[model samples]
Target: MKRLIPLFALCIGLPAAAQTPQLILESLVAKAGPASAARGEQLYRAKSKAGKTADSCAACHTDNPKAVGQHVKTFKAIDPLAPVAQKDRFTDPAKVEKWFKRNCQEVLDRPCTPQEKADFTAYMISVK
Candidate 1:
């Protein structure tokens, strides 16, 4: 019975922890309604008004999300954002929300709306 408890717990938790990119995007759309890939692309490339220096998702991610990127400040190598290039790009809902929270604050001076997040996810998924 003790061994069964742990195994059962793991089984129950597995599906919640493991999610597909489409699943995550669908959840976001549930909150924000339909997402527009074109709007997402525009937002990703738009310059920020958050600071004097130009800061946009494209500053680090580049115009092509399918290509690997380098952080402009840290110079850390970032994997491609497109799910087509990186199958794990948006697989984890927690990580997806984490990056959106951090990056939106950095680039937009505010956390992104559910609509914005859904749009971004749609755009990244569209890249092949």
Candidate 2:
């Protein structure tokens, strides 16, 4: 009974298991699914606070993937959804969290829900 008591106490004190990154990604992808690209497009075009309306994504970027942006300073023009470059970015969890937090507030007036983030990411991956 001594071992049983300790085991019970340990179980009670332990926190629930955290979700794996792959599982989280899978869940997010499920929300985004086949519609992810469309959702991404919507997010891209989401209005900023200035009330100018329209996504900043297309503002600096031209039709060509290589087209550059003037507003971002010297950074290369980013095609976030393009499949060719999809693997280059957004894979980092820290970067993902930062961008979503910043971008969602810029457009949606608040941080995105987990579902929204998941769906957005799903869409992002699909664009490539």
TM-score of 2: 0.51
lDDT of 2 by residue, 1-128 (tens): 63243245346753123323333355445444433556656655555654233245455443332333343544554554343454445444555667777756655567777766765555555553
Worst 10 residues of 1 by lDDT: 1-10
Each candidate's clash count: 0, 2
Q: Which candidate is the best by lDDT?
A: 1
Please write out the lDDT profile of model 1 over residues 55-108, one tens digit for every residue. Answer: 999888888998989888789899999999988888887799889988998889
Q: State the displacement of the C-alpha of residue 90, model 2, in Å, after optimal TM-score superposition.
A: 1.9
Off by over 4 Å in 1: 1-16, 51-54
What Cα-based lDDT does every candidate model obtain?
0.83, 0.50
